[model samples]
Target chain A: MIEIQNLTKKYGQIVAVDNLNFTVERGEILGFLGPNGAGKSTTMNMITGYLPSTEGTVKVSGYDIAQEPNEVKKRIGYLPENPPLYTDLTVDEYLSFVSELKKVERSKREQQISDIMELLKITDVRKRLIRNLSKGYKQRVGFAQALIGNPEVLILDEPTVGLDPNQILEVRNVIKDLRKEHTIVFSTHIMQEVSAVCERIVIINKGKIVAVDTPENLSKAITKNSRFTIKIAGVKASVIGALKAIDGVKNVEVSDKVEEDVYEYIVDSDKQVDVRKPIFFAMAKLGFPILETKEEELGLEEIFRELTTKNIVVSTESDNSKQDASGEAPEEDDQAEEKEVE
Target chain B: MLSVYKKELRTYFYSPLAYVLSGIFVLVFGIYFLTQTMSKAGQGIAQIVFGGQLFFASFWLVMLIPILTMRVFAEERKNGTEVLLMTSPISVPQIVIGKFLAAFTVFLTMTALTAIFPIIISISGDLVISNTLSSYLGFVLLGASFVAFGLFTSSITESQIIAAVLGTVTLFFILLIDQLKTLVSGIFLKIINQLSLYEHYKQFVQSVISLKDIVFFVSLTGMFLVLVMIVIEKRRWSQG
Candidate 1:
């Protein structure tokens, strides 16, 4: 188990991590989510004892990292953003060195080195210097280095960044296999990869955590208006006419025209409202047959955007209301009253 | 400590670096030995031991210092292997001492191979056994200081080029401290010049078994290794 409490890292005037708090229980795979420069790598560096936090504590399996670094280091395996590999040594020789530094018994070092290479499927390249291996194989060699000493915690920073599609799946599968025993904290900017591999997501933005929730709940909660987009082979006026007349449709508008006859329209409804059946019937009655009616899913991407951007949106109405009451910008009071309900 | 020592030592032999540097040392001294001994210039046993040890001691240290110690920590940081060492359970001193021992072992092997010079001189003429023994001891002490300088250079930078240049330059400065004493007439300059590694190696080269010279060489080696340890410790504070 890894417990990070109020972890903050400040580099001069800029704060890279701002009082961030999160935890990974045994057997939990947490997807560390953030945009570029969102402190994902900094946070991982702190947890793995690569860099120290300006404030707060990181405890690995009940051992305080700062107080007992060797204890914490013994329990955690870190693969930094760049794989820290020795290019001169062969893979087998490098692994043996790491195994010894990790305090593996001399008797079990050989067997353990072989087992880790077998696990990552790098046994074929074990005799080769790491400098000669391709990017994917080098990454696997790095992964093999982490698996030495069989530490319970694994912190991988962008594990599959440069891998091919097939290699990405294979690496994902290997991480999943390790999930049964190890507490994994893997960071990535790709949301789809998080959804595929992570059981929970902690989205970070601008040095602060925006949200922490299950992927399904985040997707559902952030889809506020239940909006639907449909492309139909009909006139814009008729499509809007058909959708606005539905019982549960809150608003309808023709968004774009794709072809001479096909139109793209947006339909907004109340939360939990399904207007596909009503729109199909109304369009059929008007003699404009519905070509497509599919609900637009508010995926992890949208949820991430909403959570990260919520702070800066001042709503414009609040500004106007304050100005109208205080007699500031009094000439715009009439316009402000017009938009009071906005 | 043992593990890192083994890794560093294996790295020396696995690559061509160790053989190349060691070959240069033997080759330089081989030319010197052939001219002095085989060409009949090393007529007396005393002359053979005195000249052989002096030639081997200086050049062996100059070439081996840069090649053997060039990559100790600087290369690890550049090639991205410092993360493995820092995150491992081993402490900083263990790593410093381990790398030091590894580089010193290579120096010892180089020194051992030059044993052929003394044996070759002995085969042709009667050997001045006592003088030959002190000359070998003198070479060993000087080489130990070179190993210390190699590691100290490696610790100061992440670029091996810079490390090699810095180590060679620092050794050169210490060697030329004698010239400074000659140029200046101050008492302090004379005292500082006495701290030079070559200045202290002089007494033992003439087969004078002075304890003060032994102390000077050993203390210089110990001081540099400790300074390397302090620099490594200070780096962790920056991370914190």
Candidate 2:
């Protein structure tokens, strides 16, 4: 339902969105995953006809945004990062104004607004001033505004950013339900938000597309090494030696000491190896009881960090190496990752 | 365009700024009316002299029109609501025209309330119908031009205060261009005198309904409104 081709936005010397190419099928929820300053909002603005791309095109329902903006805008409903609300207007008044601005039919305006208000669960606060409402309510009202014209495509820029956890869950559920009828392109820095609702995730960083695939495929493609964490009641040296002696074990590092004679070891092995059963038998043969065992599969959070941080590390490797003389580049990388995630 | 016009009008009524500004406009006009009448009472002239009253009221436009128009586009940009308007199906010209008309409506309403002075004068003495009507026509045209200028200033900035100040200062200069005639001579002095808004407005006050003055106000208003539309359209491409 939507196609973006080489969509680039430049602010003088800085390129905010660079040759971004993507598509959204009808009734599909495409997740836009990126950290701060990742040009997600810039991309969304171009798609909604609010901003003109310096060089490229965005088409909605086969109409070019630059050539026929009104036709494209007619099919897309956008909720910007700030929600674009008039605080002095009541909920009903704001929605009514949006409906009119969208050129909804006069006869169906009231019913459509009520239905949207009901879907967003903002019916009770319909008469109250939007300024007096809570943040969550304001967000829902913003969402309700996007649903007013029943547009085919909805471009929401961080719909759940300022909401509470429950409100976030509620919004996710709403997005999930919206997939039955509307094609959704939502941007967020939250990993779980995309994993929970989007059919395909597009991870972008520094104005470029890093990875695009389903959540499962993205995780599976990046994690090529099988890792296991095991806790055994034996001397730490013996536990490490026995684990390394296994046929497919690549490396064994004692990560922590859980208790006396009980050490946790992180076991790395070849991707094709099933080392869990072998490690169990090896520990049993050594008279070392296995206290606990866990197969450490990479979660979406790690995959996101790995995808987004790899580029940063490559671009600034020289600067990073000079900054950290102790060869703790990995630790510094982790700190940089944390800052980006926050 | 109609939708935006209605929404803007509704917003004006909802906010207290419109009420306060309109109240001040009426109060000031009433005071001027009473003073003009009291001072001319000894000449047996019970005629409602609105030409002088409107000339004074034009000064109030320097203050009140900016206050009325400062928030038209500046507030939208500040609140991030410009995104909503730009992304809608409406055209930039439509939004500009809609807002221009909404502000014009409020100015008309404020000026309409001053008609009571003429009604009171007509009850006691002869009413100069042509002069009163021409003066009002000139005032409306002049006010529309100021509204357009103020709207243009509002479109250029996100801060309402800056919009108001810019609108007030530029408009003050435009209205008082004749005063600057003293600083120049020859071609420059003629240019300054010709650019004076008060010069064009004085013809209407004297009941001279020349097409030249009418065209000047209409074209000036159109030019400013077009500038507002261009500024809004250009921002879409230039904004980061």
Candidate 3:
């Protein structure tokens, strides 16, 4: 449905988006994953024909954007980062205006609009002014606006940015549902969002493509050593010795002390090893009761951080600290909501 | 183009700016009409003319038009709605022309309201219909040119106040060129005389419908509209 080749955008001496190449197959949900200012929005804007590329071509439905922008634009429904809303207009009024702007047929405009409003669950507030709505409702209206012409390609730039957890889930589900009919290119810094809804992920950093693969493959490719965290009630030195004595265990260290004589040991092993059962038996043989055990599978968050922050060692510590300060799951959501309110 | 025109027209009425500006325009027009007509009470009613009223009204446009068109493109850029328009299937020329027409419609409506002055004169006393109509035609043409200039200024900046200031300064300069023409001679005088908007406007005030003046206003309007489209297309490449 879409093909982008050698796409580049530069601002004087600064290159914003550098030599990107990707394609979205019909009905495929492709995730554009990157940290803040990773040229995600710039790439999306170029794809949607809102910004002209400094180099290369973006062809949507076989029409080159620079040469045939109207044809390319006709097949795309874009939700920009800011939602492109007119606060003075009502939801219905805004959607109707978008329908007209998109050149939806006069006969089908009303029915199509109502159906889209129903899909986004914004029908109830259709008559209300957009300025008076909360952030979540306003976002839904923006989504509804994008759906007005029923374009075959949907370019959503952080569609769930300011929504609460429930709203985010709802938007994720909407994207999941939309995958059946439209080719979607969704961009976000949130790791979980891409893993939840996108079939394939494109990870970019500092205006360059770092990794492009399935989420599962990306995690597997980055994690070469299997790691385990286990808590045992025994003398710390002996616990570490037993864990290290295991056949496949490469290294063992006391990660933390949970309580008196109870220490958490981080065990590293070969990739092919199933060291959990062996560690359990080894601890039992030493009469050191196993308090708890967990295999720490590297998640998309780690993969994202590893891929994005590589070679930028000076900034890695601060990025990790920032991620740690926000407790992982709802950090981006909370920060974005705070910004919306302000 | 029609879609943009409709939406822009609706936006003008949705805010209080249009109403306030139109009210001021009418108030200014009425004051001019009353003073011009009352001062010539000793003469016949046929001598009570709209020529002076329209000439003064043209100056008011140098102030009012910038305020009217300041938000046409600047607000869209500020609110991030330019993305919506630029990404749509509409061409840059279509968007510029649609916005120009919408602003022109509002100017026409404001000009139409002042027709009440002429209507009263026609009913109570003798009135020269051709003179009154020609003055109106000239005023509308001048306004169209001012609106196009204002729209071009708006397209170049994201700040509405800055757009307004740029528009007012340029329009004031265009109007003032007529006075400056007398101070120069030779080729410079010829160029200034041709560039002066009021110099072309003077013939219409005398109830003359010269095609040259009509063509001048129209070409000026077209030049500004084209400049607006160029600015928009250039920004698509140059804006960050």
Cα RMSD for candidates in order: 8.3, 5.5, 6.1
Q: State the lDDT of candidate 1 residue by residue for A1-342, as single tens digits.
A: 888788887655456677777778799999999776677877887888867778999999999989998999998888877888888889988898889889999999999899888877899999999889999999988888888899999999889978889889988998999999899999988888899999887877656666666788667666667788887787777778768878878898787778897887888897777777777778778777667666777888877777665542111221112211221211212222222111
State the weakest 10-residue window (summed lDDT) of model 3 chain B: B41-50
Best by lDDT: 2
* Model 2 pairs whose backbones collide: none
Q: In model 1, how large is the Cα lDDT of residue A115?
A: 85
**Model 3, C-alpha of B31: deviation from truth (Å):** 1.2
TM-score of each: 0.85, 0.91, 0.90
Q: After aligning candidate 3 to the native by TM-score, how far in Å is the CA of B163 from where it should be?
A: 1.0
TM-score order, best first, reads 2, 3, 1
Question: Per-residue alpha-carbon lDDT of model 2 for A1-342, expressed as tens digits?
Answer: 888888888776666776777778899999999877777888899999988999989999999999999999999999988898999999999999999999999999999999999888899999999999999999999889888799999999999978999889988999999999999999999988889999988877766676777888777777878888888999888888889899899999889988899988898898888888888898899999998888876888998899777753221222112221232212122222322221
Instruction: Score candidate 3 by lDDT.
Output: 0.85
> Which DockQ value does candidate 1 get?
0.37
Task: Write the residue-wise lDDT of candidate 2 on B5-113 in tens digits.
Answer: 9989998999998999989999988888878788788766766666767877989999999999999999998888999999999999999999999999999999998
In candidate 2 the C-alpha lDDT for residue B146 amounts to: 95
Question: Which residue segments of model 1 deviate by more than 4 Å?
Answer: A229-236, A245-266, A270-294, A305-342, B38-47, B184-186, B208-212, B236-240
Q: Candidate 2 regions off by >4 Å?
A: A230-239, A253-265, A272-294, A312-342, B181-190
* Top TM-score hit: 2
lDDT per residue as tens, model 3, A1-342: 898888887776567776777778899999999877778888999999988889989999999998999999999999999889999999989999999999999999999999998888888999999999999998888888887788999999999988999989998999999988899999998988988998888887766666767787777677778888888999888878888888989998888988899988888898788899988888889899998888887899998898776632111222122222221221122232222221
TM-score of chain A of each: 0.81, 0.84, 0.83
